[model samples]
Target: MTGRHILVVDDEPDIRSLVQEILQDEGYSVATAEGGEAARKARRVRRPDLILLDIWMEDVDGITLLREWSENGGLPCPVVMISGHGTVETAVEATRLGAYDFIEKPISLAKLLLTVERAFESERLQRENVDLREHAQPIIEPQGKSPVMAQLREQAQKLAQHNSWVLISGEAGAGKGTFSRYIHDQSTRREGPFVEIAVGSMSAENSAAELFGAEDGETVNYGRLEQANGGTLCIGDIADMDLQTQARLLSVFQTHSFTRLGGSEDVEVDLRVIATTQRNLEDEVAAGRFRDDLFYHLNVVPLHIPPLRDHADDVHELLDYYIDNMVTHERLSYRHFTVAAQNRLRNYGWPGNIRELKNLVQRLLILGSGEEIEVAEVEQAISTQSVSGEPTAQIVPYDLPLREAREKFEHDYLLHQLMEVGGSVGKLAKRVGMERTHLYRKLRALGIDHKKGIE
Candidate 1:
C-alpha cells in the first residue's frame, strides 16, 4: 500500500507549511496551496485523496471555494475545513457543502490525524458500496471445486504476493476479468481502486485520451492510469491495443510515470498492471502488431486459464452456483438439474466456458417450467442452440495465421449455410450474397461438394 495524496489550502504560510510537514511525517504525499486560486491549480495538476481547506482566505473565502468545487466537479476528494473563529453555524454550513469534518484552528495534532484517517476510511467504504450497487454480480474469485480451478486459484494467490505485472491468457468467457479482480482483492493494494480498461472496445481516436488522460485549460480528465494510482490496472484484450498507445504504455511501465495529453509535467504513478488477452500475444509480437518489449514486461507472470472443456467435471458445480445466483438475484423460480442432465452437460463441450454455463442455467430457469431439468431438455437446448448458429462449440485457433483462420471460418460458415438452405446452390448463393457460379467455384476450392448443393 502507498501513502494517500492530500492537499492543504490555507492563507497562512506558517500553518500550511506546518501541516504539510506533519502530514509528510505521517506518510502522506502532501501538496500545499496558499489560497483558493492556487488550490484550483494544484487540483488541476493532480487529484488529491483528501483536502484540508481553511475558512478564511485573502482572495476567495474557503466556504465560497468549497461551494464552487461542490457545484462544478462535486468535490473530487474529501475536504476537512479549518477555521480560526469557528461557530456552530459555520460548521453546519461547511458540512452541508460536503466537507468531511470541521476542525477549529490551533488544530490539535491528535484530532487532525484521527479525522483524516476517518475521512479516508469513509471514502473507501462509500466507493465500495457504489461499486457493489453498479455491478449485478460483484466480482469474486472464480468459483469451482474442480482440481484445475483449485490449482488456478492457488497460483493466483501466490502471484498476488508479488508486485510483478501479470499476463492472463484465456478463451473468451473463461473469467479472465474475474481472475484479475480476484488477484487485486488478494494483493497488498486491496483497499485501492481496481481500474479495468477494455482496450479492444476503445476507438483509435479516443484511445490516447482515455488511457493517458487529457488536459484542456481548466478541465482535467484523469485517465485509467491516473485513476488506478496505487492499485492494479487490468487491461483487457491488450493484443488489440493500438501500436501508438502500446508505445506510450511501454514508456509508463519503464518510467513509472506519464504525461497527460497536452500536459508537460510528468505525473508519477505507483501501480501494478495485469493484462488479459484471448489472442496469442507471442504471435501478435511476431506479426509486428504488439511491442516485444511491452509483451516481455507484461508476461513476467503468465497464467493460462483452461477452457471449460478441460475441466468438464466442474460443470456440475458451476451449474449449481449460477442456478442459485439467478434464483436469489433474478428472483427466478428454482429448478434442479437431474443426474442425467448434469452428466450430459459434463460430456458436452462449453466453447464459451463459465459464461456460457451461467447463460445456460438462466435460460433453463426462464424457459423450463419443470421442477427438475431432465436430459431430454438439456439435449434439446444444446442442439437447438448449435443449430441456431449460436457460434460453434469449437474455440477458434486465435494463434493461427490470419489467412488460415479466415479460410477456416469461411469453410465452416458456407457448409452450415449450405446445409441450412437444403442443398440448393441458388438459395445458398442468394442468401450469402454471391453469384451461383462463383459460390460453386469457391466451394470447390474449399473442397466442399458443390454438386450436392446445386439447384
Candidate 2:
C-alpha cells in the first residue's frame, strides 16, 4: 500500500477502471491495461509489484500472456488471475504458471484486497530468504559489544526515528550499506521501498536519466527517486554524483520535486534521503567539487560509522558470526577457531575492516582443513594478505590520468615527509627543499591537514 504499483489487465474498460480505482483508493499507484498487448507494454514501461490479469481477455488469453512472460524472462512480478468462468483445471494451470492466487470476475472486494496484501507479504519474505541464501547479512544489525559500537547502534536507531535527511560517512566496506538499511528498517518508512543508487558506479552521461527517469511522447520511465516515493532513497557515494546531476538533486531537495528528462511536469517527491560517502565531503565542498547547499541539507543528521580497527574487541564475535552464517546459509563445513587463532586475529590490523574480516573467514572455511583452525593457518593468511597488500600499496596507479597520478604521488610524498618531520612545517620545508610559503600552499591544495597525523 505504500507506493506499490499494481497493474490491472482486463478487456472490459469498466473492469479495468473499476479495479484501478479500488487499488488507488487503497493507497496503491495503479495502472490499467485493456488487453494482453497493453499489459505487456505497461510491464515493459515499469515493473508492477502485483499484476491483476483477467484470464478471459479478447486478444490473447491471460494464460497465454502469462506463459509468454514466464518463458520470455519470467513472470515479472506476483500475478493474480481473474476470471468469471474459471474451471478447476484452469486454476491449476494458472497456479502452475506462477499465479499467486485466482479471483472470480464478480470479485469480492474484501477477498481481492486480502489476496493482494498476502501476495505482497509473501513476495517480501521470498526476497528476504533469497538474500539470506545469497550469504548476505540476513537482517542482523551491527554485531559488536564494544562501547563505541554499542553507542553507535543506539545513536543510529534514535536518529532513524526522525524525519530528517541523513548523511552517513565511513571508510569503504565499513558497512555503510548495512547502516543505511538499518536506518530505513528503524524508520516509519520501513514499509516503503528502499531503493539504493550507487552514484560512484554510475557514469556521467546516464546519471540524470537513471536517477530522475525519462519521458518521451506517450512513454514514461520511473526513476529511482519516483520508485522510492513514500519511502527512503539511499544514495551511496553521493560525493561522486555528476555535477549536473548534483544541481538537479539540489533543486529537488529545495523544491521537493523534479522534472524527468524531456518532461515539463514536475514530479512531487515525498521521501527521506539517506546519503553515504567515504570521502571528506567538507573537503569536496571546499574544493568546489560538491555543492555546499546539498552538503548542508544532507548533513542535517550526520552519522560516522567507526572503522573496525577501533573496535577490535568485536573481531572474535564477528569471526564466529560469519562462520555460523557461512555454515547455515552456504552449507560450508564449519571450523572452530582455536583460542590462539582468535587472539592473533584480534591483534591483527584489519586494513579493510569488516569486509576484510568476512572474506578471511570465508577463505578459511573453504580452504582450510580440520575441525579447528590453528594459528598457523591464520598467520599464513595474514602474511599472504600483507605481502599482496604491500606491493599493491606501493604501485603507482597507472590507470589515473598523468596529472592525477602525479598529484597523488606528490600528496603522499609530502604527507610522509611532513609526518617524518614531526608535523613541523619548518622542518618539512627544509627536508622537501621548498620555500615555507609554497609548501604551505601545496599542503592546502592537496587537502592535507598540516597540523594532524603526528604524536
Candidate 3:
C-alpha cells in the first residue's frame, strides 16, 4: 500500500477529505469523489489500486454500483463498502454483492488502513493468475492434427474416460508427460489428483515409500497411490523401478489395494495408473530386469508417442507455439527468422523433441543478440558445440512462418545451452531466472531432455 492510489467515494465532502488526509499522511496516494457518478469517473480516470465506496449516494448507492461492476466485470480494483447506517446485515449483503470488504461509518483510521492494505494484496494475487495462465496455456493445447498424433490423443482421451491402466512408450523427449496430463485432464476423475513419480530419479526404497506410505508405526504420509485415489497416477520412466519395488507395485495393481510400508492395514483405492518409459519394456522383460506381469498390467492401454522426426509436418506449428510463448514471457520485441534459419529448423534432426524446441525459443528470445534469428546464429549456436563432430544440418525451406522460423532458431539455441551446461536443469533455470519446477515443466512440454543435450 506504500505507493498504491486509493479512491474515496462518498457523497459527503467532509468524510472524503478526512480519508484523503489520513491515507496521504500514511504515504498512500488518495483521490476523492463526491458521488457514485463521480466515483465511476474517477475509477476510469485514475485506475486507483483500491476503492472505498459510500453505500448511500444521491444518484446511485454504492451497493448498486458494486452490483453493476460485479455483473459487468469492468473495474479491476477491489471495492470496500462504507456507510454510516451500514448494519451487519447490510455489510453481509454488500459482501454477497461482491464488495471486497465492508467498513462501517466512524471507521478507525488504523482499521481503515489495515483493510486497505489487505485489499491491495488480494488484488495483486488475483493478477498473478493471469501470469500463470500465460505460462500454462501453450502446454494446454490439444495434441495437433498429425495422423499419428491424432491417434495418440484419441487413445489417451478414450482411455482417460475409463479407469483402465495405461502405458506410454516413447524415446526421450517424446512428450510422454504431456500425453499423461492430457489423459488426466480428459478422465472422469479429472477433479482428482494426478500424482507423478519419477522412478529413475528417486532411490528404489525411498521411491517405494513415496508410492506406498511409510511403515512401522510411523504416521503414514499419503503416497502417490493414496493421493490419486479417485483419479490418475503417472509413473515416469517406470522401466527404471527396481525389482522389489516393481513386485510390491504389481501386488497393489493386482488387488487395487495397498498398505503403508510399515502399516498392516490395507487401503483400497480406485486408481488409474499411467506408466511411461523411454526404454522398451519388452526388452527389459526379456532381460529379466523388469517384471513381465507388471508390464502386462500397465500395457492394458498401450500408447506409443511418435518422436518429433515422425511428425515433421507439425514442426512449423510447434515453432509458432514456442515463439509466441517466448516473445510474451521474455517481454521481447519479437523478430522473425530469416529464410535460411527456417530451412535449417525444418531439416534439423530434433533428437530432443518438442521440449527441446521450447527451451530453444525461450533462449533465443532472451539471449539471441540479433534483430532476427539468422542461419549464422543457428550454426554458431548448434554446430560450434558439436558433441558428435557432425556439421550442422543444411538449411531446408519447407516454408514456415517467420515466427515459426524464429522458434526453430530458439530450439537450436536451447540445445546449445544444454550442451554448454551439460544438461543441468538447476543451472539452466538459474540462467533463465525461472524456478526449476517451471523449467522442468517447459522442458517436458517442449520435449527437451534435462539430461542429454545435442550429444
Candidate 4:
C-alpha cells in the first residue's frame, strides 16, 4: 500500500498538470494546488508526505509559505523547492527554511523520481533511528505507590547521577524500556541524542554493520553507536544479540572506539549505554548463548522491573492513565469502568503485564460500547483467549500474599452472608453491620456477585 501523498504547488496550470500526471503514473497519490492559498487549504485537508512547491507563486512565494509553516507548527512533511530561474542565494535561503532539497525547473524527470524516492527513504530511516517511545505522553509520576515501585524509581534516580551503563531486566511488556527512558531523561545528558536500536530485529549479517558504521568506498553509513555519540544509546533486546556482535560490542565498551566495517580510521565516541533484557542474562551466559564478558559488563548497575501482579493495587491508577492515553492519542471514545469491572481487572494475573493491560483497555474502547464498562463486559472480553479458556475469575491461592489473603477472607465472608440473605445485597449489608456503599465497594473488589445462583 503505497499510500504516499505528494502535494504539488505551482501557479502554472500546464506545469502542474504535467507533473501531476507523471507522478500519478509512478504509483504515487498526487494532489495539486494552483497557488499558495490553495496549497494551504490542501495541506489543512490532509498532510502530504512530500510537497513540491514553486518558488514564484501568484499569492505567496514558496519562501514565505515555508516561513509561515515553520513558524506555525514546523513543516508537516518534507518540502522540495522547484524554480526555473532559481539563484544560489534563493536555494540557500530555502535550505535554511528547512527545504528537504532544491529541484531546479526544466526538472530532470530522472532526478525528480530519484529525489522523491530518496526523500521517503530518508524520512523512514530517521523515524526508525530516533527515540522509540511511541505515544509519548509525559511519564507523569510512577502511577504505582507500591513500596517496591517507589524504591525502584529511587534507585533509578540514584543510578542516573552517574554516566555508568545500566542493564534493565523484566518480563516481556513489564516496562523495562520505560525505566530505561526514565533513567536517560533523568541523567545529565538528557539534552543530547537518545537513540535506540532494536537488536533482535537486525539480522546476523547486518547486526555488526548496523551497530558499528559501515563504509563503502566514498559512501559511509553511520550506525547506532555514531548516531548516539555524547548521549544515551538504548540497545533494546540486547540479549538477542548474536555472539559475534556481542564480542564487537564488548570491544566498544572496553575502548570507547570502533572502526567502520570497511574503513581504517577509528571513530571514538563519548557514549552511555542502557541495555534491556526480558531473560536472565546469567542463564544465557551459562548456556553459551550470550557472552560472559558482556553479561558482567551490562550487569554493573542492573535494575529489576517487577511484574504487574506484584503491585496489583496500582491497576486502578494504570487503568485511568491508559484510558486517558487512549482518548488523547488513539482518538478512542472514552468509557468509564464500573467499580466492579475495575475490581475484576485489578485481581487479574496479567501474564503479559502492563502491555497486556494497555491492549485490554484499547480493546474495550474499540469493541465494547456504552458509557460505562460493567463487570460482565470485562468477563466477556477476558474470556476470549483466557488463561484456561474458561470464563472464570482467578482463584486466590491458599498461600496468597498477606494482603490478598485478607481480601480473600473478606470476600468469602461477605459472599456467604449475601447467599444466606437470599442474594439481597441490602439484607447482607445490614446483617454484616457495614454501610451500604462501602460494603458494595468491598463486594466488587472481591469479584463477588450477590445476584449469582438466585431465581
Candidate 5:
C-alpha cells in the first residue's frame, strides 16, 4: 500500500521543514510550502491526501486560502488548521469551513500524527457509509458451500497475500466484481479504498480524465488512480479501454507514477490493480483492439471465474442466499423455493451466472405472492423470459433508487430486445412500443449503439 501524502503549508520555513520531516519519518509522503502562493502551486502540481494549513501565512492568510479552496474546487482532501495561538472563534470557523481538526502550534508530534490518522480514518468511514447507503445490498462474501466455490475462495485468499496486479476473466454477470472485492477485503490494504471503474461504460474522450484526473488552473478533479492510491483499483471491462488510456495505464504500471490530465507534475501512486473482462482479452489484443503490452502487464496473475453452469452444485446455496438477501434488503416477503424448483434451477444452464441468479430471486419474490416458490412458477418465469428474448438469467439491481432502477430496467430491456431481434433498430422500436426516431434518441441518451445494440 502507498503511504498517505501530506502537505504542510506554513509561513515559517522552520515550521514547514519540521512538520515535513516529522510526517516523512512517520511513513507519509510530505510536501511543504512556505506561504499560500507556494501552497497553491504545490496543490496544482499534485493533490494531497491531507493538508496541514497554518492559520497565519505571508501572502494569503490560511483562512482566506481555506475558503478559496472550499468554494472553488471543493476541498479535494481533508484540511487541518494549525495556529500558534488558536482562538475559540477561529476554531469554530475552521470547523464550519470543513477543517478536520484545529491544532495549536508548538505542536506535539504525537498529537499531530494521531490527528492525521483520525482524519484519514474518518474520511474512509464516510465514503464507505455513502457507498453502503447507495448500494443497499448486504456485503456478502460469495456464499456457497460447493467445493468449486470453496476452492476459488481459498485461491483468492492466498493470492490476496501477494502484491501483484490481477486479471479476472469471466462471463458477464459472473461475479467478477464480487471476487475482486473479496480479494481487496482480505488483502493487506483492506483498510484502503476499493475503487472500481467500468472502462467500457466511459467514452474514449472522457476515460483519460476519469482515470488520470484533470487539473484546470485552481480547479482539480481527482481520478480513480489517485483515489485508489493506497488500495485496490478494480477496472471492469478493461479490454474496452481506448488505446490512449491503455498506454497511460501501462505507463503507470511500469513507473508507478503518472501526470494528471492537463497537469505537468507527476503524481506517484501505489495501488494493487484488479482488472476484469467478459470478452477474451487475448482476442482483443490479436485484433488490435487492446494493447498487448498492457495485457502482459495486467495479466501478471490471471484468475478465471467459472460460469454458474460449471458449478451446478452451488446453485442451491446461491438461490437461498439471494432469497434471504432480497427479503432483508429489498424488504420483500419471505418465500422459500420448493425442492423441485431448486432441482430444476441446479440442472439448468445459467448463462448469466451469479448476477442472473440474484435477479431471478428478486423477480420471483416481487412477482410471486405464494409463500413458497414452486417448480411450475420457476419454469413459467424462465419460459416467459426466454420467449421475451431476455437472457435465461438477467440482473436488475432492485436495491437501487427508483430513478436508477427504472433506467437499469429500461437499459437491460432494450439491449435484450435488440439482441433478440438481431440488432434491427426498427423492429426493436416496434417491439418496445416506441417510435423509431424516439427509440434512436433513447438509445443515444442511454449511450447504447442504435444499430450495434449495447456495447
Candidate 6:
C-alpha cells in the first residue's frame, strides 16, 4: 500500500515542495508539475494515483486546465482542485469539470490527507470496475412485455441496481435462467463475463474440473469462478452440489480466492454471484446437504421468479416475441398465432417455462405451414410434449458395475443439474444425494467436460 503515486500540479514551487514533503512522509510517491501541459504529460506518462491541482496557475488557470482534461476524456488520475485565491464559484466549476474534490488552500494537514485518501479510494474502485468490464462478456438479451413479464423485468432491473449476491428461485421450466441473464444485463458490471455454471451438472470428481477449471491432461485451466471475475457468475441448480464441494465453494466465496485442484498459488476474483435453483435451499440446508453459512450468504437477496403457468397473461406477448425472433433469424415471412392458438398456449401449463416456450416456437416456425399458426398446431405441439414431455434417456448399466450405474447416473444427473442450475455445482450437489467428492469421481469416470453454453 505504500509508495502510492501522487501528482502535485501547482505553479508555486513553495506550495509544491510543502505538499510533496507532507505526502512523502505519509509514504506516497510524489511527482510535481508546474503547468497544465506538464501535468497532462506527467499524467500520460506515469498515470499517478491522484492529482492535487492548483486552481490559480500563472499561464492556463486551474479551472481551464480542469475543463481541458475533462474534454480530452483521458484524465487517468482523480484530480483534487486546491487553491488559495479560488472562490466558491471556482470550486464549483472545478468540480463540474471533473475534479474529484475541492480543497481550499492554507490547507489543514488533516483535511488535505482525508480528501486525498478519498480520491485514491474512488480511483481504485473505478479502475477495478474497468478491469472487470474488460474481462467480462456482453450481457445476453431478454425480450418480452406482458404485464406479468413487465413486472418481472422491473424486479430484475431493481435487483441489478445493487452489488448484493442474488438467489433466484423458480421451479424447473420457469424462466429463472432467462431472468438471471436479464439481471446481469441491467447491472453496472454488464461488460464483465457472465460465466454461468450449473452446480448440479458436474459430478464431484468433475465438479472441480468443470467449475474451478482444470487443464487438459494435467495442464493449467482457468476455473469458472476465476473467468467470471469482475462480472456476473450465474450458478444454476443450487441443489446438486454435494456437502464437500459446497464446503470448498463456501471457502472460496468467503475468501474470494481459489486454487485449482492439483495446483499451487491462489487466484482472486471479484464477481456478483447470481444463482438460480428450482429446489428450496432451506430444505437442502436442513437436510444436511448444503452448508448453512453458504446458504445464508447466497440468499442475501432472494428472488422468486413465477413460473409461466402462474403468469398466463404474459403468454401471448412471449409467443409474439419468440415468433418475431424466429422469423427474423430464419429470414422467413412474418407469422402470428391465431387467437384460438394463443388461448390454447395460455391455457397450457408450461412446465418447462420460457426455454420450453422458445424451443416450441422455433420448432413450430420450422415445421408449421402457412403464415398463421393455428390452435390445432399448438395443441398438437403441446400434446406431443415434444420437448420436455419426453423423459431423458436412461444410461445403460456399464459392464464393470464398479459404481458404473451410479457413476453414469451421476454423470447424467450432474449434466442435467448443471444445465438446470446454470453452472453452479455447489447448488447442484445439494440437489442430488451425494458428496461433491463422490460426484467428482463419477464425473472423471464419465468424462464430462464442458464450457459456457454458446448463445
Residue 305 CA displacement from its true place in model 2, Å: 0.9
Q: TM-scores for all candidates?
A: 0.79, 0.72, 0.57, 0.59, 0.82, 0.55
Sort the predicted structures by lDDT, highest score first. 1, 5, 2, 4, 3, 6
- Residue by residue across 346-434, what tens digits does model 2's lDDT show? 99878778877776777677667899999999987676453212212245798999999988888877865664443568778877889
Which pairs clash (backbone N, Cα, C closer than 3 Å) in model 1?
A: none
Tens-digit lDDT string for candidate 4 (1-455): 23467899999998899889889999888889999888876754444668999999879899999987776646767888999998989988889889999888788888888999888787666654442223235463456777888899999999889988899999887888788778878888764557788888899899998988776643456678876765789999998999989998988899988877887777766779999998899999999999998888889899999999998988998999989987885566899899999999999898878877776776678666799999998887776534432223346788889998888767766764554343567767667889999987887778876556121
Q: Over the stretch 261-318, how does candidate 5's per-residue lDDT look in tens digits?
A: 8888888788989999998999999999999998997787899998888989988988
* Model 6 whole-model lDDT (C-alpha atoms): 0.72
Q: How well is each residue in 1-455 modelled by candidate 3, as lDDT tens digits? A: 12556789998888889999999988887889998778765644334557899999999888888876666534446888888887777788777877888787788888898998888777656644652443344366444678878877777778877877889998876788888888888877765556778898798659888888654421225567765665678899998899998998898788978767666667766778899999999999999999999988888779898878798777777777767765665355576678788778778777777666665555555556667898877766565323333224335356988877766665665555554343566657766677888777767656677665432
Q: Which sequence of candidate numbers ranks them by TM-score, best first?
A: 5, 1, 2, 4, 3, 6
> Model 5: residues >4 Å from true position, as ranges?
85-93, 108-110, 138-140, 384-455
Residue-by-residue lDDT tens digits, candidate 6, 335-424: 689999888888887877777786677657655679888888887777655346432547565675777677667566666555443344
- How many residue pairs clash in each candidate at the backbone level? 0, 0, 11, 0, 0, 46
The per-model lDDT (C-alpha) reads 0.84, 0.82, 0.73, 0.79, 0.83, 0.72
Model 6 lDDT-worst window of ten: 131-140
Residue 346's lDDT in candidate 6:
87
In model 2, the runs with Cα more than 4 Å from the true position are: 1-48, 51-81, 85-102, 133-139, 215-221, 262-264, 386-455
The CA lDDT at 365 in model 4 is 80
User: Model 4, which residues run further than 4 Å from truth?
Assistant: 1-141, 385-455
Q: Could you tell me the C-alpha RMSD of candidate 6 in Å?
A: 15.2
Worst 10 residues of 2 by lDDT: 385-394
RMSD of 1: 12.0
